[model samples]
Target: MSHRAALGTLAIGGNPLVSRRVLSSVGEWGGARVGARGAGLSTSMASAEELRLVARIATGDEAALRQLYARYGSLVYSIAVRVTGDRCAAEDVAQQVFIRVWERPAGFDPERGSLRTWLATLAHSRAVDHVRREQACHRREQRQLPGAPSDVEEVATSSAVAERVGRAVDALPDDQRVAVLLAYYDARTYREVAAELDIPEGTAKSRLRLGLRRIARCLEQEGLGAWT
Candidate 1:
């Protein structure tokens, strides 16, 4: 199953999905510090502490991994949310960041930079990657549309569709929602969607078909079928 599908199944099984709110309220990351001198000391302490945590994690200490997550999870999730502008995608990005750190503690080089900076850089890169992929998919979708409408028509239609379709997207199941976002909304071809999502091309096609059908049904139910 797709990543979103798996996450949805887990949610159905009463497993909580980690999100920005979850990360923010997760653990105390050394509380608050005020003043320039105090801020500098906090930075120094965090860097030193993070380095130690990385070392411990590399040595198979699970507690150190938890500490690392507590320290950087909120910042990572915030960066992702800011860049992606989509909570679901941001949540996926945040989870991937911590998972990467957990599996490859040595990826962070203390001599090169502090752990926070490293994680921030990784988060930014991932979010940007997500944006570019979505843009590419959107362009492809536009290319396949019946024809280019007049400039004024295009502008007005885009506004209406974006607002209406966004609500429709939210109502879809996790797997279908993600596929629709990447395909019709983002404009990815089935092959491109399959490649990006690491799914078989046939599966991507099936998901898109199912998702679009559901979206159409939703729009119709909401009396927006004519708009679609």
Candidate 2:
């Protein structure tokens, strides 16, 4: 796959182009878990208020956008930082998150969860995309070397391993997938994942552990053992 195409298939996929897919996946997953998870966010009852703000923003209300930012800006920035590990990248991710919200406030569904959690999810996804792009650039530069047989072999092996891992992650159940994504890719702790997902700590740990074990088995079956 081309580097552009591989973004969506990889675990590190993140970019405005793929944000809709990530949002849709997380929104659907959140909707499904509502009854079982009961608003896996810090503030359960604030979604209604947030929904009003989103509706206002949807109608070209700039003040509403500012208000929404005021409430969750810090949270969004922190999530970006966790995923990108650089202040500049985090700032860019934060900007993308707000720009996305301004352009499509309806994307944040009150039924799925609070605006905070939804935006945070988007922020993390975008940050991951930035990291992926940087890594891809580095890969491209390394591939420019002339007649490096071992480097070519290593790159091919790495790509195959990444593809296998991505497929395995894609096959995971929604809840487990989100937990693993947040915990492993987003650099969130189990406690943070549980808090963000509005589940108990023990449940978060269980899902991550079980999900990772399944991924390992899948990778091993696929003859990808570096991680497994």
Candidate 3:
């Protein structure tokens, strides 16, 4: 069975995604079967409030941690997936976020941000770390590979977002764009980016500042200022 189907089956008592198949298959599970009733319940899959559970988790409540996962598992998973672009890595990032939350609940200062936002930050950081590590490994492999330049060009021409980013990157005034891509997209440290670009650290700082300001202005002029 598909993962979603298996997840739905395990969630039979709690999930709202139940289908007629589940209704019919109920009796097949023997003692676990209920009345085989099929009245649609208007209940949300996100049945618990994440903040409240997080609060309880702060006090070392294990059940609250489980409830928090049930409430926000998909949200956390989604952020990791989007950031990492790898299912296995996303799963690992999601697991790590929760593990950290469980181990040091007091580390979460709700005053800094909402539980959801904090979780997103954690997911993003983990994904960024993974991406950087992968990039470093790729750089090493590229050094050993011959005729890799042709593959890079073909890959750049293949995707819409990649093409758009390529244009934006091309438009950038060398230094600014290099730093922006290095720090933001490659997820490298500003100091590291500066070192890689063969420029002073302050120059890297200036590049990021100028690049971001330009991007903000351009996006705003295009009526995407809300994202800025």
By lDDT, the best candidate is: 2
Top TM-score model: 2
Off by over 4 Å in 2: 1-43, 140-228
lDDT of 2: 0.61
Candidate 1 lDDT tens digits, 35-99: 11122223433656677788886775656656666555666766676567676777666656765
Worst 10 residues of 1 by lDDT: 32-41
Pairs in steric clash, model 2: 14-129, 40-197, 40-198
Question: Model 1 off-target regions past 4 Å?
Answer: 1-43, 140-228
lDDT of each: 0.58, 0.61, 0.54
Residue 113 in model 1: lDDT: 63
Model 3 weakest 10-residue run by lDDT? 36-45
| Reference-based TM-score, model 1 | 0.45
